[model samples]
Target: MGFRFRDVLTSWAVPSLADLLLAALVVRPYLLPGGLDELLSDASVGMHIRTGDLIRSAGSLPHTDPFSFALPGKEWFAWEWLTELSLSLLHSWFGLAAIALAAVVLMTATSALVLRNSLRRGESAFLGLLLVMVGFQTSMNHALARPHLITWLFLALSVTIVERERRGPWRGFWLLIPLAALWANLHGGFAILPVYLAVVCTGLGLEAIWNRTSWRGVWRMVACGLAVGAATVVNPYGIGLHQHLIEFVSSPWAIQMIEEYHPPSPSLGEPFYWFAALGALAGLTAVSALRRRGVSDALVCLFFLISACKSARHIPLFVIAVTPIVAGELRWLWDVARRHGGRRSLVAIVHDMDLGLRPQFLRHSSWLPSLFLLALAFRGPLGLPSTFPEKSFPVEMVERNSATLQAGRVFSTDAWGDYLIYSGYPRQRVFIDGLQDYFGPALGNDYLEMLSGGPRTEELFRHWKFDTALVPVKQPLSRWLKARPEWRVVAETPLAVLLVKEH
Candidate 1:
């Protein structure tokens, strides 16, 4: 088929208001003075970047934990090796700005895919865009410079591809195998791919059996699921990857103590606000209008919703899974409105808006690529920031008291341990970091007990023989240390304090 003028215009044009909005949302994070640096909220990025650097330096992935003092040489699974390598390369080439920009690009692309998939599933343009925006907004809470962002992008692509295959032939279903392989190297979340395939396949099989239709697609889906599952073991750790991830996820301490693993709470702020509102709307629509949408959509939505309820970190996954269903439900409402004269105020407003009308000039603007190139070219080196945000971390205190910190064994908060590894790794190793698996339940519980100043806190500290401590100013350990004659205050910042054992 030759490319027609209309086809060219549709392909090259600015497209719709939704496209413009998505572009804006993607670039907005990079507009601040720090650009992508502003989004580096979590200290985990430091460890990830450092891991990537180490991998590049050694020319192979490490099989043991090297960043922590608590468990040096313990077997470690660098499941996010690919993402770490990519981040390190970006940081080396364009500085942290590039790494941050990469994150924004991944998130925006995921949102764009969701929007496209919803429209492809017969949703109206406006409704699709609205639903995608909600999903994007809900995910903003966890949208830091981490491997999870890459996982989100792959998850969206996997779902779109699988859904397409479910609706049609199995021509592109095999693509999931290579995707699974790549995903396995990028993040441990690759395990979700096989589960997603299984759920969809089972749902389709049940539907076919109930309606007495051909089971050809169900068999194909089963084949695809097995292929993807096999691909997941293609990483450096091979079968060990699955075993490590299973242990981590199944850990009671990780599930209960980790903030991200905790259930979504309205008390937490914006993440919950959008999640609660959209979740209620989606649930109601699913019950009333989405019955005919098929069992697969219902199963996927319910699975993600329950997962999100169990852990707030899964909210974005839930948002991505439910967006198309919500869009389809809204499309049904729009059709009903159209049948009833389409004169409803809300319907009239959406209809009158020229969201689909592409202007002639914008149809061939095509300057975005060149503009982005120019921006990156002119964008000079990003001078490393002297300190992290004091509100979120103890950057100032760490820098001011670097000598004192390196003088002895130091015990710090889990988040602070991540920052220390990024800033002071060779000179200093941490008691604990974001790597909950490396520490396991014993050390993790010990660290938590010290932080909470439990009865065994003194005993744990004595066993570790930590002479220097860096903790939040308001934490129980910090407060208790302040009153102890054996520990003397050495340095203090607005958000953090440092103490040293009396000589």
Candidate 2:
């Protein structure tokens, strides 16, 4: 553990470029204006913390409503209880600093694994950076402090392990069995791994059929898949956890209403555009890569691509699946361009530059520890975020009307409801929050009807008996409230208005 002066100096002065990139990514969020608070933009993270805390205090997982006043005794499935417990423990131990750091590390690891996979597949260092950049493009938009990010990390590692096993001798592919158990507790995104496993096995099996190779690899994957499936049932809920997840994802009511669960559309902005473009590239390259040895790559990429297209939430998963495949094929593209006598072309120039940059990026030293220590030491100066962004959440509105929030049942968007719990939970409960699966379709329909001014809007509203409503200025409900004399605006911010109903 002793650090030699020369070792430290060499590491600092001539650090690994890969390590430097990772360090920069890890440090960026902490150094930003919001510090680690930027990750809390989702606000659902608040309830997760509350749930985790509840689990810790109660000495058991919850099976009934714990944070919602809307449905006081509704059955609940706290499937991600382990992740919540860890988040609560981290918050208690180091505040948001630990939570933020953990998230950033998962994100960084996912991208780094993608880069490493590309290099292993024959792409140069600089070329792999291209996919890494594109992967980050869409992921940052959904980069909240949640458990799903852990799945991205585990899936990346799973791909690395499976691919290595495909190439060489038994190289720890069996480890994925235990990891699957851990992943199931962390996030439902573990569900994607089974899909990935099936895709890989089918693709590799196809390759064997075409090349007349051994079926051992394919059978090995099948065995691994069964083992992984069994491991997922190791949770407290056991087999019922899988049954719950299946029903939740398949229920048209749940997935159709949630924006993230919806298919890609123009309203999603730049991330949608980038995903469309990358998705197109993945399709083209995946189908064509089969001309070489991209059998497994094509199947895996196409499956995730289809999933991401169906639900925008799957885009990061799609990105992880395809980046290495695309990077590897792009090298073949560069070679083709070279054979066509494009030596003086811009492609050639970039290729030349990549060759020159490879040595610099590959420089190995003790940069990981150096950069990690730097991140931890700078936490104080960086100013750990005390609250989420006001623009994204009703921070000021909540602060000014904290008493009203605690004194009455509130109705707001799920995100605002989450912030409410984070700010004043045990004393305050919302009519609804982000846990759509737990609330079920009837409540979801009522919520949408209430907001949209449907025929039963007033009826649902009166039935719910909401005392306070905090809504965005632009929402239809805000305008609806304004037209009614019974609802009065007590406190206002530029982005949100807090309205209380007359008793």
Q: How close to the true structure is residue 456 of candidate 1, measured as C-alpha lDDT? A: 96
RMSD of every prediction: 3.4, 3.2
Q: For residues 146-234, could you state the per-residue lDDT of candidate 2 as single tens digits?
A: 88888889989988887688786585989999999999998888888888899998998999998899999899999999999889999
Give me the displacement of residue 236 in model 1, in angstroms. Answer: 0.9
State, as a TM-score between 0 and 1, how close model 2 is to the true structure.
0.90
lDDT of 1 by residue, 1-503 (tens): 36697777666655455456777876665566655555777888888888898899999998877777777677776778988898788777876556665676678778877877777664466677677777777877788878898788998998789878877786887899999999999988888889888878877887787678888889999988998899888888889889888888988887776788898887668768889878886677657543674666667777778888899889988887778777777777777786676566677666555245323212323344444456566556434333345568877678788888876788998888888877775576778889876677888889989998989988988898889999998889999888889999988877888999987
- Report lDDT per candidate: 0.77, 0.81
Q: Itemize residue pairs with steric clashes in candidate 1.
A: none
